[model samples]
Target: MSGSWRAGLLAEGVSITVTAKAYRLLRAILMTATEDDKMLSRNPCWIKGADNERTPERPILTLAQVFELADRMADRRFKAMILLTTFASLRWGEVIALRRKDLDLTARTVRVREQLLELEGGEMRLCPPKSRAGKRTISIPSAIIPALADHLKRFVDEAEDSFVFLGKRGAFLRGGNFRREAKWAEALKEMGLTGLHFHDLRHTGNTLAAQSGASLADLKARMGHDSDRAALIYQHATRDADQKIADALSARVKAERKKARKKDH
Candidate 1:
């Protein structure tokens, strides 16, 4: 089972579940083999599936780091992206696929309707957003509205559908250059911060939305998430508000108990 059939079953024609299983078995084999031989330089699991089953942790950024990255960014398009990422929590694909027309300056909202993928070679183009519900609008502050205006005046060109954040050579930004995750890594390092990722910017935005008293429904809309559950995960991820909620609940219960004791007295 660990030979050609296993390799073929883990190949492109294999089901995702089978590939996932292969990854788990492959990990065990490599670990066992490596523990026995410290100098062992290779693992044959590369022939079929991935080395591990775990997803990498997504990163987050602080507000200060977001501001720092925006300030340090030399390219105007890149700077715009940093701000939008921090503010809107839009995925890197969504932002890079954005068109000038996707914004409504009057309403102070941006439509996240599409996502871009970097294919083999240098080709890139917009597909739909990650999910159907991922196509939604999110409000921006007036400050961002003006900033976008300035950006459009200075950077955007061609037509209304032209990419708002065109690379200097005028193409969709490659994911290797960015994708929220990679950019967060770059920005955190640049700003002298540690252990943050671009996806954390989305988390930061979710935390901000929650702190601003946005309802779960509202947060979902703002985040362009696919479900209420996904938005609620932010409420779970954000510790401060949950702590505040716990504190408030304890106060109410304690006060009631104290009042009851006083009445009996």
Candidate 2:
């Protein structure tokens, strides 16, 4: 009915999840609020609207799709950045904050213990990661080692741990840099894929690892999910790998049946 009511329901554990009807109702309420609906002032539902958005069970990118996305981009630095985001599941802020010293080429690991954040007062600061477990060092995949090495050599300028992605000359790369987003969206559109979000790249890494038979405990540690239940979200959310595995089993069964028929002759 109202945003307060919906928010209260959610806050009180009345609904385990958002329903399609609830989503539509929330959307409609937002529209009405924009059109001067005084009854919905300070709507808490608006704050949590993103949680209502649907997410795929498996956000894995196929090997082909990963390579295809690479081939679409000419800027090696941008390509490398996107690849790191997809492969290492580095958050955007962490990527921007990365320094040369943070990477251990010998160990092939990237420590994500810090983040560069622009505070409310508009001062940029490099601080410890948001959560305690976020202070982890994850091993970088060997597939992109060369790409990252090249990126560090060519693109990154040493300004005393300043920034890896400098937007212009002295300005730090802000999230408002629309070129990357527009380019990604256009590329996805050209490839006939829809509903790709930047954060979904992290999901891509999680799903790929899970599909490749990595244990949930390992995935949890890599992804820095604090608990088993949080890790299960990755498993429960990604069903594409399950479908592909099932298809493979069915094909094997069909092949076995064909062999049996042939042997009967």
Residue-level lDDT tens digits of model 2 in 62-173 = 7678767765654455767777777877766677777777787789888786877777666878888767777778888898888877877888775546455666454666
Provide the clash count, candidate 2: 4
Regions more than 4 Å wrong, model 1: 1-60, 120-122, 178-187, 239-265
* Ten contiguous residues minimizing lDDT sum, candidate 2: 7-16
Give the Å error, residue 94, model 2. Answer: 2.0
After superposing candidate 2 on the true structure, give the runs of residues whose Cα lies further than 4 Å from its correct spot.
1-59, 118-125, 158-162, 178-182, 236-255, 262-265
Q: Which lDDT values do the candidates have, in the order given?
A: 0.69, 0.67
> What TM-scores do the predictions have?
0.68, 0.71
lDDT, model 1: 0.69
User: Which candidate's lDDT is highest?
Assistant: 1
